[model samples]
Target: MPLARRSLIEAAAARFGWRRAYGTTTEVDQLLNEQTETAYRDAPDHAALATAKNTDALTVQPGVLDARGRVLGEVLYLEGLLAGARNRRLPQELIARLEDVVDHGHELTVLLADTVRATAAAHTAGH
Candidate 1:
């Protein structure tokens, strides 16, 4: 495809994608924040976070916050991308794979958060 065509397609993809993926700006930003926090939390523990997955398709298991201000999972960042591009004619296989990654990330994030909280509680009690 020509540069112009490609740019148009990409632009269209982003515009249409964002519209279809999230209902509003607030949701998009919230999801983005969730994803960011997961990254920050996981950085100190490389192995645990590296195990999380990613995708280019859509938002699968987006990050979630529980009552305790703990992160639940890996926060599939691309899940937001995928959500934004839901209207795009992406392949089914890609979508499925992305969904799987998102779910896996979510599970991992939750486990890691629990571990961190527990560890902190233990440390506090010991002091």
Candidate 2:
């Protein structure tokens, strides 16, 4: 499923659980907001990698062994790459992304609430 839809489902499920058990809309809304905000805050960082095209700096010597031990010539490698690169940039993006994620989460929570309200109304009308 699409990432956004999956996020919605998870939030909706949590909200439904809270509402069904406690009949508390406020609590359920809070829970849904918290969950969804977390998800958006954690969205993948595609922007940081925009500079990844600089991989041309790598110089791979001919004859590198693959996992099967087969020799492969001329592998394109990334130069000046750090093992903890992602970790380093994550902190930089965290606060900004957290706010973005929170906004998205709020939208998701609102959408979920509307859907639930509509579904319940439909069921009530049918009955």
Candidate 3:
């Protein structure tokens, strides 16, 4: 609603959204780096890095990361926002949607973890 509030939302999106979404900082930074390179690859080194730092949100996806750094899907980013940081009363419909997003997040997280573990094991076994 206000400038400060909007800034706070964007900051939260970067912190809570990206980390929780991808489940790790390394992978998240990898995606961020890739996105930065994709955008400023042709620019001078310092300029590119600065641009990347400035426009990171425009580059990296807010949530989720691909194992091969490709395709992925999005889900809730603020599912736990109110629980952890703030408590705002939301409409019933919005609350239900939040619940659904969280439910889907749980399911997808488990699926992704299992798939990644299996893939790692197979690679270790020389697959």
**RMSD to the hidden true structure, all candidates:** 13.9, 27.0, 14.2
Error of 3 at 105 (Å): 1.0
Put down candidate 2 lDDT per residue, 44-122, tens digits, no spaces. Answer: 6645553453232121111111211221111111111222334465464644555455456455545545554565565
Count of residue pairs whose backbone atoms collide, per candidate? 12, 0, 0
Query: What are the lDDT scores of the predictions, listed in order?
Result: 0.57, 0.46, 0.56
Candidate 1 lDDT over residue span 10-118, tens digit each: 5788887643366787766866886798799867764455346423111112322242234322254657756755668588776787777778767767675675566
Off by over 4 Å in 2: 1-92
Query: Relative to the unseen true structure, what is the Cα RMSD of model 3?
Result: 14.2
lDDT of model 2 at position 105: 49
- lDDT, candidate 3, 1-120, per-residue tens: 454674576688888655334557775686587668778876668656656664533232222235322222344354664243335676666577767666777677777666666655
Better of 2 and 3 by TM-score: 3
Task: Return whichever of 1 and 2 wins on TM-score.
Answer: 1
Q: After superposition, how far is residue 21 of candidate 1 from its true place, in Å?
A: 22
Among the numbered candidates, top TM-score falls to: 1
How big is the positional error of residue 80 in model 2, measured in Å on the Cα after superposition? 35
TM-score, prediction 1: 0.39
